[model samples]
Target: MKKTFKVVVDCDDVLFDCNGYAVTKLNREKEYAYKKEDITAWGELGCGLDERLIYFRDPVFVRDMPVLPKAREFIQALSRRAEIFIATSVAAECAGERVSSIIRNFPEINPENILIGTRKDMLKADMLLDDCPDHIRSAEVTYPVLFRQPWNLSVSGVISTTTYREFLTLVDMVQKPEPEMDPMSPVVLVGPSGAGKNRVATALEETGRYRRVMGYTTNAGSRAFYRCVSWEQFHYKRNDFVETSSYMGEMYGTCREDVESVFREGRIPLLVMDINGAVNMRLEYGARIIFVSAGKEECIRDILSRGLPLEETIRRISSIDGEMKNETLCDMTVSGTGFRVSSLEKTP
Candidate 1:
């Protein structure tokens, strides 16, 4: 079956030529003449004309403005593949004029799909194409695409598009399938400290099928191998990391940028983390978690062979029972003994 995306599109700068209309109105009605390129700031109007007065109070101008270039054609094409909604906000007095303008210009759009409200973030959508920063920041489910405008050029982290054609290209990038040789979803291998999880992760990385994402750690010995940040830095920038946990007197975390970077490069990120970190990740982003175990006896023996104190070995082994119970939480479970990449053939 084909996948259908739920897309919410904005109207002002995205579909309607709001800026052009404002410029024309300002030049014709107001004392100071202004061009489209001259109005660079978001809500700025030349000759001290307020945006609210021009956009909201003027009903005749809102009703007669032209639709944005190529907007009607793009929306018509997009409606065939995705469930499209026109999400816009306007003054209560001129709401009818805005709706009528859309209906008169674009007959393809269903009147039921027209949504007019001040808070677009409350709408449920998979993706949002808008030019407003406040709307993008407040959005809950939609991945924002800042439709190119001089006002929103400084916004960060969200995708941006200069034209409707470029927007279609970005949509294709998000929905296109990866190569047949590439693995599907990113993998997170979770196990106890002494269960050879790192060794298994290394083997999978060596296969060239996965990109190993090193989590942040404060351990002095592991600083060179993994991405290491100070405990204070981690605390100060907590939101930068996807998941974090304290274990064995050191802090470890998975950086959100690392996972997104790997995904942007069209590769699956293979992460090695403890059960606590894995559970936290599952709660946040719903990662594909795999539990790796080598049985209780083998785990204790392996910790002892590393020359650690018996007390530490027992302490690590004591946590095995809790970790084993997490098997029910994972998508798949595999034995760590003699593990190979073929073991993951059945994985999605």
Candidate 2:
């Protein structure tokens, strides 16, 4: 099946003759003819090498320059199937003129789509065309098409198009795929204490794929755990803070309010849980359960070394190694001994 997508075009070199304007600006001011290598010299002029890009800021730069060969026709054709956004970056001082030049080129282009910032990181366009190497590198995060310019020959690991038509051809060859995710289900991870349950969650958060839901508890908080409740709330009078299976004079329950808070933030919530809580959540929400474990001796040693009580540590070791129905609740078991938080992964 053919894939449909939104398109964003870059103004400078891909659609407009920016290099020609840059050459003209230098010649008019310096009384010298422009050369391709002269581009580097522009960066070296006034206010260090950075100030040279300021020449593109002049409104006349875009007004006087002609559209790149066939640039206008290609954009008009692509606009039929895609919502085209003209995403570009120009000097801040001349933003008004730069935007004016853009609108003058394509009378129908939306002013909202005309961007003027360096944080190409914030842009969410499907395709971008420019001559600069750094702009291409930044757009890779979202798989946007990057048109090659003379300045980008030194960049690596990037696919480049030399012309606007070639870019359209490139996007046509490779389809932009939509993501598949279970609408009602979130990616769930479960593991024993120190088995790296929270560690794996931390890793996922870094990738911007999932969100961490602080597991609620009735027990006194521990800093080692990813999220913990303060003693004040643990001692607060509430039925939700009751014990799971009375071992001594302690209570263990997942704080429903906290978990829900994470969901409210519009991200897939990740919760660390004891076997009882993990299983309960699985039954209630049918959440994906990941069981993390370690050998009896190794687990016990780790538990104690982290300052867990000896009696409590021994109790956990016995249950994990014993023949118990709870052991079957895990969807996946990952080795936790000497576990590096960064190495955790989910089995597909």
lDDT per residue for candidate 1 within 1-348, as digits (tens), equals: 866688888988899888877767766766566566665456654645554345655778678778888888998887765788888887777789999988887787789999988788788877788989788767774456667575565443344555676566445434542212224566789776577787787878887667888778776556334767787887776788777655555667788898888888876788887654554554445566787977888887787787766755666777675566545546677778878778875444
List runs of model 2 lying over 4 Å from the truth: 1-4, 37-54, 176-348
lDDT of 1: 0.70
Pairs with backbone N, CA or C atoms under 3 Å apart (clashes), candidate 2? 43-49, 191-292, 216-255
Q: In model 2, which range of ten residues has the least summed lDDT?
A: 241-250
Per-residue alpha-carbon lDDT of candidate 2 for residues 1-348, written as tens digits (9 for 90 to 100): 844465667777777777766666666776766564445322354422233366666665656767778877787777765677776666665677777777776766677867777766666655666666666555633444446554443332234454455555444433422223343344456444445555566766876546765544444544544334554665573445311222223434555565566567766656665543443454445455555665555555666677667766666555444312223445545544444434433333
Q: Alpha-carbon error at 167 in model 2, in Å?
A: 0.6
In order of appearance, the predictions have TM-scores of 0.50, 0.44
Best by lDDT: 1
lDDT of each: 0.70, 0.55
Error at 328, model 2, angstroms: 38
Off by over 4 Å in 1: 1-4, 44-52, 179-348
